[model samples]
Target: MKFIHAADLHLDSPFLGLTGLPSSLLATVRQSTFTAATKVFDQALAQQVDFVLLAGDLFDRAEQSVAAQAYLFQQFDRLDQAQIPVIVSFGNHDYLADQHQTVAYPKNVTVLGSQVTTKTLTLADGETVAISGFSYPQRWVASDPLPDFPVHAATDWHIGMLHGAVATGSDDHYAPFTVDELLSKRYDYWALGHIHHRQTLNQQPPILYAGNTQGRAINETGAKGAYLVTSDHGHLQPQFFSTATIEWATATLDAANLTTLTALGTRLTDWLASQPAAQPTLTALTVTHLQLDATDLTSLRQGEWLNLYLRTHARQLKAAHRYLVSVTPQVQPQALTAPQLDQQYWDQGAAAVFTPANLQATFGKLAQEPALADWFTQATQDATLRPQAEQVLAELMGKEDPDVS
Candidate 1:
């Protein structure tokens, strides 16, 4: 028996943290989710898989995107025409709701409900498979759903579909279950979702997360796709296939002895020329071993230099089919030298100033605005805030030696 397991399609979800993108590139970004999903269906048809399992989050219910809805209808029809069965289980983003339930998917598609239910399929080879899963009733399902899931069914193969996370001991919004608990069910396979990084929890029974179909942000780097599982020697084996048309990557460029913005631009162009992706790539560039004067460093720190470089080097970027999302400086603390003030004192000052409370207070009324509030929440996260603070300190220290530039 063969089937494809995929999740987190996130169809028509807006590309996050993108700005100043060329209109053509923006259009591609907008359609990327759909494009990635189409590839999954195309593969399903080509492989002639008996069934396809979409673990969850087919689309963002909050967005209520018309295009996403229409695209699914069209694709499901395509699968129906090919006589391929599709099993869908909606996750947190597109949970089971009365409004969505009003419109039914095509006859070929079986959408799992809020309660744990089992669907049995008979493969062409006379193999019987039982699939058990459930969709989220609301935004969160606090309770462990394992108790509701029945023991392995009396079938040739039993596969479990789940869109959730591992137990964290506290309040877990998603359906949280431990690996041991899942193994206790004695299912042949577990097609998991929710987390956007594809990974296998168990090898024997093939428990795994298929990850998101496409990369929407820089953090979701590398090849994003789904799994094609085939029964091999009484064991279910899964293989990953790429579906993402636009890939997100982070690369560190060594800027040692490179001084001017023009030199950096040339280096970046050369780097793009050397490392080419099959699909259009969006890169988050980090410059290490960088040495720049006060003004240049300030420009890099403020993203002014990177923006200017991008604007000036449009031809090179287009030729390489690459876009620089951001350029971050990865300089050491010792590199940010201030003749007047000690590094320890500067660090102490930063420690006092860059706290969450301080940042929230500084943001003041901006927090009241929804869009700004969301940005503020992410921007104020420790990972983001620490780098920004370091950049600011570097800029300030660079200013100490104004004549050096």
Candidate 2:
């Protein structure tokens, strides 16, 4: 009893936040989702799993992408050739809709409907298994779907598939359920979706999320992939495998020895040369322990220096198989601490000022302006606002007094 559990394919994802990249890297980024999906199917073929479970959000139906549709049909047929069964439960992004069913998937594919239903399968080894799940009827399902699920069936294994988050008490638009509720069902395993970070809610009977197959943004950094679960001695063992062709990462470089923009560029180039990536990596680098002057720091902040560095060091970037998506200074908080105010006091004041309520109150009537309002809203929501403000103040102090350190 072996199967691959995967979710949040997002096949037509635009890989947002990536701009001003070289044509070659941009092309790779564009194809990264498809490439990552191909690896999953390839793994299925290689492992010869009895079945595959796609928890949800296979593709964004709103996009109406012909390529994504064609790709799914082609890949499903490939699995059909191997006589592998695929169970799909569409999430909010690709909910149950009449238009989408205009063309059906291959015979081996089983797409659950909007209502909870159980599908029973008899493995080649004569073991019976029951799989229960449902697809989202619309963009949001505020109600809890746990009550609709039946207790463990009279089969060798009972797996419950759900595509929603846990009960958060409020603002939970997705089909929310609690761990206790899922445990009450006594299912052998619970395959989850919607949340894009792979994690396990429970070890016994294994309540898990297979996460997205590809990293679509910088925030979704690290290895993105699916899990291969194999039935052990009365328990299921799951293993994660990387499927993403390109990865997003954040790194830091010490600027203790560098003083000029030229020195910084040379050092960055040398650092890239020192470390070559196994795959195309998009890196957000931060310069720490900064000693740069105000003008150079301003250039770095404005992205002018980075743009020039990327353009001139194109060969080095390509050779290293890494792209510097962003470069910024990480000003030490201690540098901004005044003699009159201790570090703890400064921290407390910054925390108090950065609160959502405080920031919103500070914005006041200016928030009425459309464009400025949007930026203000985002700024207030940003977690690093306080740190970024401190960095700005530190830069200003440095500009005012070059020998401040």
Candidate 3:
């Protein structure tokens, strides 16, 4: 039976990590979801797949943009053209019951409800493929979805499909299921989702989460995409397919002892050049222990020539590949003391802002007068602005600053 398995197509992403990129450029990055999904559709059509199984997280959130819906329709339309059947379960991100307007699945699509539901498919060999699943319904599911595993048709094979957090004994606030319960049913294939990383939990019965269709952020790192499951009458062998067109590269140039912007730029450029030709998109970042003495990211954004060069470079490396050159300051291990280890964040800002070099290099330039410098220093004193000042200092230090409130 030919079937395509995929999940977590977070389309029209807000792109929180991506910075300095013009709103237009950001829009383009978000648009890559369509391209990625289109590739999956193309893969399915090429395989002449009889059905498509979406384990979960079909969209980023319940409040997904219309563009996401539109793009999904375009893909489901392609599947519909192939006379393919789409069986889906709602993941934590986008559960159908939570949304105001139900997503319009293609005529051939079958979305399982909040409770256990099943659809029986009659294959050409007269064998039946029974698919059962459920939706998240809310942000958290307290019960184990495995115990609710629908009874299968006693025909050829029964596939238990679900979107949940799987664990034997744990209070994890996601979809939690048990291996013992799953084994008891003995389904031919167990299609799973929710976890971004891919792993083959069971070999005896092929069970898998296709993983997020695309990596939305740096944290969802490494290869992201779907799994292709091939099963005959006896056994099933699942192969992971990397369908993501965008990827994150945590490129670090150790500046612990060495210095100079040209050297840093060279290190970054060399790393970018080292990227394989087949890599569609990459975010190259540099981590410096000592704050670098060079034109900062602000300068790169303001200087017309530098800005033009960076954009041209991103465009030059294939229209799809985006090489984001971001820099972050690295702190030495064992540098932070015990009291500082967990100083409630407020204290860290007090320390970082009062650092000799930072006070001079950053605040010393303020207004040329001691009082103004004192005032600039005092503005960071307020508990309210301490967090903001810390973030500003992060920007100054070339650290991947957390999102400003």
Listed in order, each prediction's TM-score against the native is 0.84, 0.82, 0.73
lDDT of 3 by residue, 71-117 (tens): 77778888888788888788766766666544676798887888888
What tens-digit string does per-residue lDDT give for candidate 2 at 1-405? 998999988887776556767988898888888888999999999999989999988884445487888898999999999999999998877777623544579999998999999999898899888999999987678899999999999999999999998887865667999999999999989999987789899999899988888877666788899999999998888999989988888888887878899988888888899988888899989998778877888899899999888889999999998999899888656457654457898788777777778877888987654224424544234565666777778756655654454
C-alpha RMSD between model 3 and the true structure: 10.9
**Candidate that scores best on TM-score:** 1
lDDT of each: 0.85, 0.84, 0.66
What residue pairs are clashing in model 2? none
Q: Which one wins on lDDT?
A: 1
Candidate 2 wrongly placed segments (more than 4 Å): 97-102, 332-405
What does candidate 1's lDDT look like per residue over 120-176, in tens digits?
999888999999999998767889999999998999999999999888875466798
Query: Per-prediction RMSD in angstroms?
Result: 4.8, 5.6, 10.9
Cα TM-score of candidate 2: 0.82
State the weakest 10-residue window (summed lDDT) of model 3: 331-340
Ordering by TM-score: 1, 2, 3
